[model samples]
Target: MATLARRALWPAVAAAASLIAAVLVAPAPAHAHGVALVPGSRTYLCYVDGLQANGQIIPSNPACAAAVAQGGQQPLYDWFGVLRPDAAGRTTGYIPDGEICGGGTTKYAAYNAARADWPTTHLTAGSTIQLHYSNWAAHPGTFHMYITKDGYDPTKPLAWSDLQSFWSVTDPPQSGGPGGFNYYYWDTTLPAGKTGRHILYIQWVRSDSQENFFSCSDVVFDGGHGEVTGVGGSQPSGSPSASRSASASPSVSPSASRSASASASPSSPAGGGSGCTATWALQPSQWAGHFQVNVTVKNNGSSTLNGWTVRWTYTGGQGFEGAPWNGTLTGQPPNVAVTNVDWNKVLGPNASTSFGFNATGTAPASAPALTCTSP
Candidate 1:
């Protein structure tokens, strides 16, 4: 009778032990929350690029895809959680170099990569734009916006020394997120003369808790009006531009400046005179001292277009950084031409396609006008 009673208890004891072990090994959930929406942060934009109707994440952008490969999709699901639990508003010495974008957390470490191919927001220098910071878990806090030093290198790991506080707002107004995102938003002006590529670092310090949120927004001061590229999709509904206010802080001079110049309006389109048009754009270069440009070809004719060729001349002595993508490169730098690939040779009326290439040398302050021809 005693042996039978002991055997009956064994199963219950084993089941209890298993439950305890499972609980002990489970990963802790991060308490941090919130991220930027417009001029989208790395994680936020990557999340947008990966999210699907079925609730599964599958990134298409090369940079976003690489980040997912390094860190599972959980980070994207918690896209607003690039934060530190005990930051207490500390900067510089607190977060280690090369991990500022990831908020110095291992969970978000994949976003710390120094690659330039991350999705980017395009804006004009000295322009006033609407700022949209996510409010996943609303709290009383102050938000600070910082810009990279003028000579900051985009291809290198971001460091505290590379940033300077430009705009700060406390307890801003909350509103429905543009494009279905919830956010605390305000308007601020970009620093003047900013060009090429730069990181807009956002830090939100909660007043009631020691937790803080951090994010990195890749942007180009290339005279754009809120157009985004490299993500390969449409932008959230609503305009990115906003009026400036006196309540916002004044702009400051940059500590240093890079040699590259920004295009006054990078997306200026050129008509081929044959109902075909080509517009040039800048993409993240991902290489030290290099930049990438994409040319979008469109057919405005009423009929189907069989083939097209686009040609341009760089005004800033820019040279090709690598082989062209989605098209064939012919001719030399400063005066180059690109032809359609087999897959994109045909286009219906009003249809469009794009091709890009990486290049080294100074990026022009104004997009070089492109000439398109159809054969």
Candidate 2:
């Protein structure tokens, strides 16, 4: 009887141990809470995708709420929508979407469009328009607005000259607490008798105090006539004369800037050694001496970089002297300097940093080769 009892006791102990192991190994339920615009919700019918549970789109469900309450997850809040007006007689709606995580960090998303059912009668030539904007998110930030006259291309951006005007929130930037909201009004006059379709582009930036940044949204506008009414106040006078002369200006190019920022991470060569990569901005020949050359370095390898060296050859320029602590160029043009970037030296896998130097001499029309070494 004693031997039989011992055998039964051992079997029961083994079963209990297995159950505990299973409980420990099982994954917690997928936490999917974030600010999502319900399709067909009230006056808006848009979808907010790719929202982060703790970072951007806080989970509002009971399970997520419970988890957050238990200090296991981050809480999220929704952003309210508002209107923004620019120098040109155009209005746009700014909506705060939730947050998303990319490249191991959280980024905010904002919805941009024209106000729903804005009276067209108020839109006249030379009419100074005031945009009544608002913010209803937990995080505080300001919205920037841009207007494109020839309409916008999702794949191809319009030329800089085609942009009618732009506006941004003023100093002492806007902010909001939990369930807090703000309203702002911007004033701009419409161009005289310039009747046609126009596209409005709006972007938001989180304040330095906040950790979130705004993601761009698609543009929308209502192209009606100057006969509608019953929205805001009357239009202003003295519309500026419209000009149609096509002139190419030396403004900054969006494609070039985006390419510089986006090309920070390049795929490693099939058989290359372990290290990071860096790229320099394209400088035009005429403006070479007075220009600043910005370079972005990204770690493509799996290892962490404690220190790195960026080497490049210039035909008309001098060699690098040294760089600032954060890789900023602080010396005169034509001389090479090493930017001492201690903060940037410790780059993790797939991380990137940007630094630049002023160039005195003209840049060669063609781009020079750049090499990076890890220490």
The top-ranked prediction according to lDDT is 1
List model 2 lDDT by residue over 145-178, tens digit each.
5555544342233333445545565432322222
State each model's CA lDDT, in order. Answer: 0.67, 0.32
lDDT of each residue in 1-375, candidate 1, tens digit only: 011122334588776665455333322224436787666788877765564423345776678889989998778767778988899999988999899999999988999888777767666788777676766678898998999999888779999989999999999987642222346778789899988789999999999999899989887776554445545333222123422110010000000001012222456656575788987766432233455565778899998888889988877778864345446577787788888755456778987666656566766767788888888
| Model 1 residue 192 lDDT score | 93
lDDT of 2 at 277: 77
What TM-score against the true fold does each predicted structure earn? 0.55, 0.27
Give candidate 2 misplaced runs (Cα > 4 Å): 1-274, 283-288, 318-325, 328-340
lDDT of 1 at 145: 91
